[model samples]
Target: MRFLLLILLFCFQSIQLSAQTNNYSISFDNAVHHEAVISATFKDISTDTLTLRMSRTSPGRYALHEFAKNVYNFTAFDSKGNSLKITRENPYEWKVSGHDGQVNIKYTLFANRGDGTYSQIDETHAHLNIPATFMYAPTLNERPIDVNFSIREDLGWKVATQLPHVKGNTYSAPNLYYFMDSPTELSNHKVREINIDGQTVKFALHDPGTEDEADTYFEKVKKVVIAEKEVFGALPKFDYGLYTFLACYIPNASGDGMEHRNSTILTSTRTLANGGMEGNIGTVSHEFFHSWNVERIRPKTLEPFNFEEANMSGELWFAEGFTSYYTNLILCRVGLISPEKYVEGLTGTFNYVWNSPARQFFNPIEMSYQAPFVDAATSVDPVNRENTFISYYSYGSVLGLALDLSLREKGLNLDDYMKHVWKTYGKTEKPYTIENLNQSLNQYAGEEFGHNFFNNYIHKSDMPKYNELFSSVGIVLSQDDNAAYFGAAVSITDDLNGKIQSNTKIGSPAYKAGLDKDDVITSINGKPFPNGIQFEAFVKKFKPNDMLSVTYLSDGQEKNTEVILESDPSYAISLQEKNGDKLSKKVLKERKDWLKIE
Candidate 1:
């Protein structure tokens, strides 16, 4: 028995030593045309046929984006440089056979979009989102991976990525998941770094702006990193003791922010010298907060994220929403935005979530499940999203606000609760479920408190008493009682008529009056509408409870209706002082503690 055990151990060690690494190389010979030549070499193959596929989904995204459509000129070869047989398995996959224990495949990749989920290779830079640029074998997913980038030195391009560097222009990943999560940017960019709590955080700015602008913007990035670190009580134990921010703030880049295990991609068309200095920092705050929230304090449903299909999770409310709540709040805490600006900015999202009829259809959990349909998804069919769906981002953000203020009423705060969660799950790198979140809250703030909060908000669509909650912190939630409401968005047409641009809200006056998208309003109050003015100004002439004879064209048919105007349902939140209300000592203390004001 002892001899047999030793022989088996020796055989396992031999197999491990013979395991192969998937090697890839990318070059931009036709970067001017937004094309990249990529090749992958697989060695020591155990199967007679190997399957290669491009990922249909990307990290931090919930939708399927057919990456295979961008690949062309695909060819396979054996070790002797002889051509091999290739078979089409599907639109996303190809099968190669008759390889002599090795296969080398080359393909042309056409990438022009510059965002978090897509790859862009142009004369300015190569912003490569890994999954959108590479093809991998599902069978050898456990094997180590290596990539070498042949950068264009004439363009002064340098590589910025989260993948651990093995040598010059080459990087390695432990497995397929990590490689896909690593997006690379090769540009003539400036880099700024800081060491926090013994871990290094870097910001690589790819922009056409001055060095001073880059320096000013990187200061905000540093402050965001530090503020978010304080929320989780510490930075995540980054692989290789490093975290990177790959930022592309240029004229052609699309605005997006995506979080990964060790880094994030920040792309925007707004340059730092122009509006982006303040405009882009909000995204910076949001994505860095995700380093602790979704990346490490992960959701079990998103564990081992699927590359071939949309990855959905019911916990995006807490994962994405809570981070969103802190997105602006952290900026306020870090002095990027004033406390008044932060509080006042709440009005837009507050009205969006509070007044939305979508709450009648789905709870926060169910809203989170709608991610695949709405998270950067594309479709031509018209759907009633305005009436039936609320973004999980807004829904969760408001809930996080409610929960925070509710906890403060009980002499606790959300920061400590988040710290407890981070220690239990994020620091331990443990994937969690919704019940686990409830359990964690129960452990921190008693069972009854947790149960009621989750039951009322998470499991059901019941709204919290936000009016009283805001009052506790000396914030005023007020609405205009006399403002007339028009629920459908209207645009002025070229022929000087009001065109309804979207579906009216379910319970609004416009909906009750049968007004809908594409209806051209010809006259109001039995008089032809005067041209050369905005639609909003035209609507402002009427007051609440006023009756009007509205005539419009629906399906090119003239129709007239009696519409009774109702008061606007929108609400605004503001500081007590801003509203001429004195803050009591108790309310003042609560407000100070909540906003971390001096």
Candidate 2:
């Protein structure tokens, strides 16, 4: 009965930011401890009892991470600075009673992982993903929030995020959704701002590399931003008056990139001097393109993201996969990667989607729905994921390739389709459905093309006509079915015991060598196979008809097997130019224009 007061108070504060009612302030000590002390004070109270919750799932992540698992030592106080009774309602919610009109809550956050999905804090910096760091009351969800980071000034840490900065270390967000969607990075980082046609885009860098390296990388990023803007015809008018790219290239940081409303978090363990820029730029391109595709042109199913449950959508193929295609396309158009590299990347996607047996069972939409289980989701039991599922990103990119080539053949291309969708659905904050996308395809192209494309490629498990489509642009599509075969998929768990655990396919080289499942591989050709990676790397050097000796342990008994490796049936995709095929003037013209070249 007493908890009801807190719920009521939360409701009252959820309205709007007025008279400091919905205001929130948090402070943390920048120390190199696994645990960080966080004090969150909720101001302008309404009820006596207060309730707060930690998020279970974050935006862009389809999996439920149970972020509450990291929070501990929660306590509450009142306006008179008196202690209050706090109760653990559930795994995610906390209930407090006997509080005054206001509440001052302090808790400990245990964060070690650093990526787009999780939060991490240390002596150097703190990557606070709001969902993993801050707790919000259910009633106060709609209310505005003001965040102030009180850090160690001697450490030289400043804030970089899309949240509207009011003054000093204070920031303002319209609601909890926007607040949580903004990923904040704190470090004594270099700030580089560039103006793209009057729109301010800033880059906050946490790199230990040379200034020249940083400049060269961000210059390419500027080009990517401009090229993507050309695709959308304009940028999303950021409510914060600017957009930001928070990039952390520290060796201790994890490699990840997550998209946000008007910013992105690009973290990698590679320093700038290592030439990690090229690969990381793909992440930058992909996440930035999402600022248009998924941020504004959001799907109705995902607009109001539920932080407590898995968020599913059928639009990711276009949302993520088409963005995957554009990630590479933008890089290629900006001349960051060679045309051959660009083609190789697409061919890799093509080979993955087409060669995987999963395509026979799932289409792009079904694949998108499975994101909750596969996208960063962990599983304890071993299952054959490779045989049953194809990543929507892979299939969607391949679909983008086939469809773009198809459209180009008809004198209509993906750029036109993208522009049409942006104008129709993206510009007005109108959520889109698959039917809407198909309708746009129908309106721009012929109705028959849309029907066949969606029905055969998206809804059904049938490979698109890649050969004919590529032929229109003079890029011949051929396959090499007879290629060097590596045995069954190498299953490697990041653990100490280096063993062959999976049931290798019958008659394969490893199987023929009498290397049974669960056999602890001791050595290969006198080289220690202490880990799966070393073994795989050694095997990659072997070709068809190669002879080898493998040593392993079965039932704790050592054994040696002499085996002859054989070729596995596979296909290779190469461009017509690479294969010395004819490139007509039409093909050259289509390629140049499609790549945004004169």
Candidate 3:
């Protein structure tokens, strides 16, 4: 009787402890009207210093933005309203000292930039983009978060957020923790709801058009979501929301969509012309798929995100690149995109990957780790550019395709890989390591596939066997004939007067002419080539092995040499094509069967 009583007491204590450890609440007030106010309440159960943080950077963007600078009128108080001193530790972090078990921090955030935390002041309506304005305790990863928002907009203007509304225009959620830390796009956005697989999905557009267009776009998007869910076996969550904001006259604005637990904010060009729907659909698919990869199954480095500094990871390729790879596949599988279009996209990516000089220098995995710094730098020193760079997107997509093919070749398939990854990593509460990735792949392959594959391709500078992979899939990867190229690859810089200021890469012809880096090419073959276009035009007329009298200013001395133009193998991918024989009849039949098209 004594032992049973002791057991009951211990079980009751454990339940109470669990409840105490997970307590947290957030309340948002728009009573102030000018700025969005957020109040977070939590119990401090640890000895470590309590810190509040706003993300320095989002997944889609490679640049770091100090979001905490936007915060204003920050004040922390004890349960009895006594002011507690809060210190600004960094641009994106704040530290509170002398805080015991329970505390509440209140702050007013100015949302004015349409890009991040933004608000409109005109008479029409008021808008707020949430992620930029709301601040949270960075260390409370596993705790439940509740938000109460009071929004102010035009009398008739409706507000939309991924959070379930407890009252009119006011939203609340049991937990804002985990990847659910999504920004709210609160505006007079046009709302359209559709049901797919018995789940309701909402689409909110900044400048939505006619009812017919909305219906058409929503139907297509619904099909896409269904296709992805079918492949993954189930949707990540029951409710999902998409918020799209369109911008006019910006050069593919540097921003893209960001994934949250139940919502995504997609920044895109306003013009819906020239197949804009296709681009929008593709973006939607990519961001939506993140609900599976980065949101649930995350890298160890990403779990306790360093909002003040760069969180480096070697697996962003898998997080982002694999997402890129699967987007097209899902689109094709759903009949949203034709096989020819898919092949064309893959061909373009291949050409881009093969032509870049960075491929000769850095492997994909290395590029993944150094992305935060290298990706942010605008000016690339010519010498370093040759050795330490590659596009993370391109490298990742290529590997994604290669891995998919390898899986299919082994009869395991991408579907199997996705399930294995989800079961081992996605379902876990903790982020995964490189060892976890290797173990998952090895389990599916029943061999040391990860070791052999990464050692040769990922960790090394070895390129993928594109020819073999594409052929196996019945897709002919072909190069276009009219692609432009210089007989020798040359990186050029021009002066203010449009004259050749420097030749960063001295091709065989330029090298033979005694031209070096920083050499000023005054003229090509006697005629003055004043600019890049003119220089390129002059080079185009010359055939391989053709000799020309080249004149340039080298070290303030006029030099001339008989230079022979050599063919550039760097342009090989442009010249290469998947021959008709490469796409065997068997593979073509499989493509027909999979696509349900001839």
Best by TM-score: 1
Which segments of candidate 1 are over 4 A away from where they belong? 1-19
In model 2, what is the error at residue 21, expressed in angstroms? Answer: 3.8
- In order, the Cα lDDT scores of the candidates are 0.92, 0.81, 0.60
Candidate 3 per-residue lDDT, tens place, 549-568, comes to 66766667877766666664
Q: Could you tell which candidate, 1 or 2, scores higher by TM-score? A: 1
Q: Write the per-residue lDDT of candidate 2 for residues 501-552, one digit (tens) a residue.
A: 5666555677677776687766667876646355455565667787777776
Give RMSD (Å) of candidate 1 vs. truth. 2.5
Off by over 4 Å in 2: 1-16, 44-48, 484-487, 490-569
Summed backbone clashes in each candidate are 0, 3, 1
Clashing pairs in 3: 131-183
Report the candidate with higher TM-score, 2 versus 3.
2
Q: What is the lDDT of residue 411 in candidate 1?
A: 96
- State every prediction's TM-score relative to the real structure: 0.97, 0.87, 0.75
Residue 547 of model 2, lDDT score: 79
Give the deviation of candidate 3 from the true structure as CA RMSD. 6.1
